[model samples]
Target chain A: MAKRFSAEKYVAGILAGDRVMLSRAITLVESKLHSDHELAQEVISQVLPHAGNSVRIGITGVPGVGKSTFIEAFGIYLIQQQQKKLAVLAIDPTSQRSGGSILGDKTRMDTLATNPQAFIRPSPAGKSLGGVTRSTRESIILCEAAGFDTIFVETVGVGQSETAVHAMVDFFLLLMLAGAGDELQGIKRGIMEMADAIAITKADGSNKDKAKVARAEYQNALHLYPRAASGWLPHVSTCSALQQQTGLNTIWQTISEYLQLTRSNGYFEQKRRDQNLQWMYEAIRQGLEEHFYNHQQVKAQLPDVAAQVKEGKKSAFAAASELLGLV
Target chain B: MAKRFSAEKYVAGILAGDRVMLSRAITLVESKLHSDHELAQEVISQVLPHAGNSVRIGITGVPGVGKSTFIEAFGIYLIQQQQKKLAVLAIDPTSQRSGGSILGDKTRMDTLATNPQAFIRPSPAGKSLGGVTRSTRESIILCEAAGFDTIFVETVGVGQSETAVHAMVDFFLLLMLAGAGDELQGIKRGIMEMADAIAITKADGSNKDKAKVARAEYQNALHLYPRAASGWLPHVSTCSALQQQTGLNTIWQTISEYLQLTRSNGYFEQKRRDQNLQWMYEAIRQGLEEHFYNHQQVKAQLPDVAAQVKEGKKSAFAAASELLGLV
Candidate 1:
């Protein structure tokens, strides 16, 4: 087990922009121990006042989409050019099963890892989606309290983690390869609708022309979609991490424009407030389901009841009623 | 209250194709009384063995998209031309707030309503989405057992009801107008991906060319989406209910082909099994939330706690933890 600290000490350290204390507090948040949970909640409550001051951006793409490289280049640009303190975190619930996470190797982003203005934390291993999401959310608050002005929560694009990431972030950016057909199959449906912007990665050299075609195709496709409640039309652009100046500036520019629009329109604050309420309800749901499913009677009967339900031998509502009656 | 019937009587009446008993049983399913709920579950369980023999289809479109006329024409075609017993049901959870429902006026589908072979049931008057979804799901079973070989579950395309409808159907058919841009805004995001087929409605007269264009556009757009798990690519066709032969047969043919493909590939049965299990879990979730929110302490403290979470004065997770502790 990791060493622990008082909630006050952790809060003070975070507010003072002490990275070591922030990391320790995050460790406590990720820990599964009951005692750690209490301490983590306490620390989170104390630091909550200092949070919500940063822009949380969710970045996702399928495995071969150059996510790490993009983040590396983007992180450097943010710190050097934009004069922003950036923190990178990930939510990879499948990491334990996959034996490693997308951000597990810090060397993938060696330069950014070494940069003092950027903080990068890999996804916690051996955790469920709920656990990872909760910790990542708390870690964002801790990072914000520690003086970071920008946050990027990364997730593998082909999984359920994107929805969780989308819920927590102020903006959702999807990365895509140039070719739309074969490579597009790797992305899940409904994801396109959630994206605030689509970035066509590896848009240099031979891929440049193909990237432009894909961008136009995606732009037209997005136009067919219903307008987002935020009233912002999703933007599609091409960028290359190798040639940092090519589309990186455009990408950041788009984000900044989005921030200005949403903030001025009051959507940014309204969305954040809605997100806050949504998470509380989500957590309550998780807690209730956990309690019900973990009940000895429910646990024993669920398999049988579920089997009956699957076979259509029992009405799902009646079966559910029977199970709920148990606890 | 309507006169009560024994569970065996209801089951026998349903299996014997008594429409009056089927309607009464549905009324019991839609009731809010504790006694009616108990009786409804018993009837559902007894009739469960006679269910699952129908092709349950979900049809949805925005308000101005000729949904009622299309369903009326489609229902007549299924019953007269195809010689199939049809049950048409609506799931308008917004009925209570909207002052009336899309299907509330039987005159909207006068011909279908008068047909001896067709069963038309409007959305229950005043119920939560959960309540309507559960009762509608049960009503489908009742209709199936009453010898209806085809079921059409209709919903206005602009709301959350489509997801519920999608979860309960074998094939989801989305209706659209010839002109896609202006009218398409009324559809909720993610609804297009859920469709098994998109029917461009009102293809008669001057709308014919526009409908053809819309069909091609949607077909091209659907190709960019990740292939559905059913291995059936969604089909897009133009239809005109006014001129019944225009595209109605093509729509039915597409549905028939989808049914053939999915059934042969085992996706049809697999999806039904998954849906059954999904509804069970959905019910459990609803029950848990209802119990949690109705707790005296939770009911008293939720507004204050929620305001704090919404204002960022408390971390959502921490607030959820506090509320969960009280319950």
Candidate 2:
């Protein structure tokens, strides 16, 4: 709907760190129109040379876990203390009603929203009949090309979105509440083990002792897990954005130490390289499956076939073959 | 390669619980020849009507976790105490070397291997250039149709195979070694959460106290995880396949309780149905990717394209588009 621009202009603007043009280009990337898609691809290819400069971190917690406040504190700390320009994006597939998220992303945290060093975008409502077509991975590239040295991909921890977030980010940060009562709150089955670090949010007041105990428990629990592929051990820390942002510096230091160790061992670059190939294969799989499932014949027959397979009237492989045969 | 029989005969033999015919059918399913594949499909379809009657359980542990001994004890226990016919199959993709596993699965478990009420099959060595082409899933169907009351899919703990076994089974049993030093020994990242029950193996002699402590610790750890989708809490127990088979009776009792609870609440059938649909989709994805990657044009260009993408010389999506275009 906005004025169209040439791919070269968009590429130059993003590589030169022009925020206005970068925002407009992201809109183009998120656009569902066919022409817009072509323009976005062209821009992406041109800017690919300048991307991959930022550290991509994925943050997640249950809704009540003070995610917005933690992000605000963390983002501000990065800007003021670390001198890093930060871009925060989200991968919420369920956010189909785009307007609410736009308002929430911009206004959820007061200081970070207006900070020149922070570029915050809500989850893109690219919910087409097919699916969310505007990939968060592409958005990460766009932000990196725009000269953001730090990137955060925030996802609600209760859904499958964390897996997508995990695949794209270099380090995953999981926020949790202290105490066992909240164990069932705001997390999925395999997510806790995926964390590069666990930060117990709201670790002030009466909860401070509880938070410390929780940290020790979680650390022991995480230690029981086998080593992560990167050879970095996941630790648990206690922090409260509400109370002087305690333990914030430790979080940053831990990350810096991880960066130093992984970079020294060459896992940082190796992981990124492997991630690139992984995403390529993932994209191919997603594209092929989308094409198959969205075919007219499949759209009509899937429900009946699924029901039959579910009811044990037909076998899974046979039904799958029937669908593939139609394709 | 041997004489092929009619699908009708194979199906009849399988449904009639003929062990010789069942072994031959499983052999046919494992055959890599093209004609064998078609016949396997026919036999699978014909037996589909009688499949899904057996209680499928997945058992996993590291090499040192007494998996073979535990399975032997458990298998014999089921045969003599519970009067259940059991079939054991494995999903070791690396079992192509085959010698070590044969020694472990057969010779290491002398009594169970000789037990008339049990059928044991080693992992297929169909590790052709394509990798693990003979599916254990098809073998599961053939075994089930052969009137086995209990099915166990055993997997080496520290690999991708556990996820495959987890997907097909109704209950997942993970074996763990006692002591904090062995914390990283048998456990993988998310495998603990996937377990319906965890048995601390080798819990006899001096390790008994440690195993009991471990049982409590693991029980607490398992409790900290969010409930599995099935709504059944994961239980932790201490078992010594070596001594008195002390906890073996409890394992059976736990499984019996699970079966009673789930069968009554309808989650059992619902989960099986869900598993069927999930596997169908997974099979489709695997098939589609296999077809694409195996294409002559795609194969020729894939390595160069993959290297380029991995080296950051090309965008992943763009490289994917190039390869997909070839396909």
The models' CA-based lDDT, in order, is 0.89, 0.82
Steric clash pairs (candidate 2): none
For residues A84-198, write the lDDT of model 2, one tens digit per residue: 9999886666667765463237678889989999998776655542234236788889999999989998888876778778878888999999987575444764798789999
Which portions of model 2 miss their true places by more than 4 Å? A1-4, A32-35, A93-97, A102-104, A125-134, A180-189, A219-231, A242-246, B94-96, B99-104, B125-134, B181-185, B242-246
Per-residue lDDT of model 2, residues B1-327, tens digit only: 598899999999988889889989988877767678778878998998888889999998877888888999999999998899999887666566753354136787789889889998876544642234236777888898898889998877886777777878889999999887575545665787688999999898899999999999889877777676667898889888666355889999899888988999889998898888987887678768877988999999999999999999888878877888886
Q: Model 2, chain B: what is the TM-score?
A: 0.93
* Model 1: number of backbone collisions: 0
Instruction: Show how many residue pairs clash in every candidate, following the order shown.
Output: 0, 0
The numbered model that scores best in TM-score is 1
Tens-digit lDDT string for candidate 1 (A1-327) = 668888899999999999888888888898878778888899998888888899999999888899999999999999999999999997776678543466645889999999999988887656578888988888999999999999999988887889999999999999999885855477875677789999999999999999999999889878987778888999999999768875889999999999999999999999999999999999999989989999999999999999999999999999999999999
Docking class of 1: medium
DockQ of candidate 1, scored on C-alphas against the true complex (2 decimals): 0.64
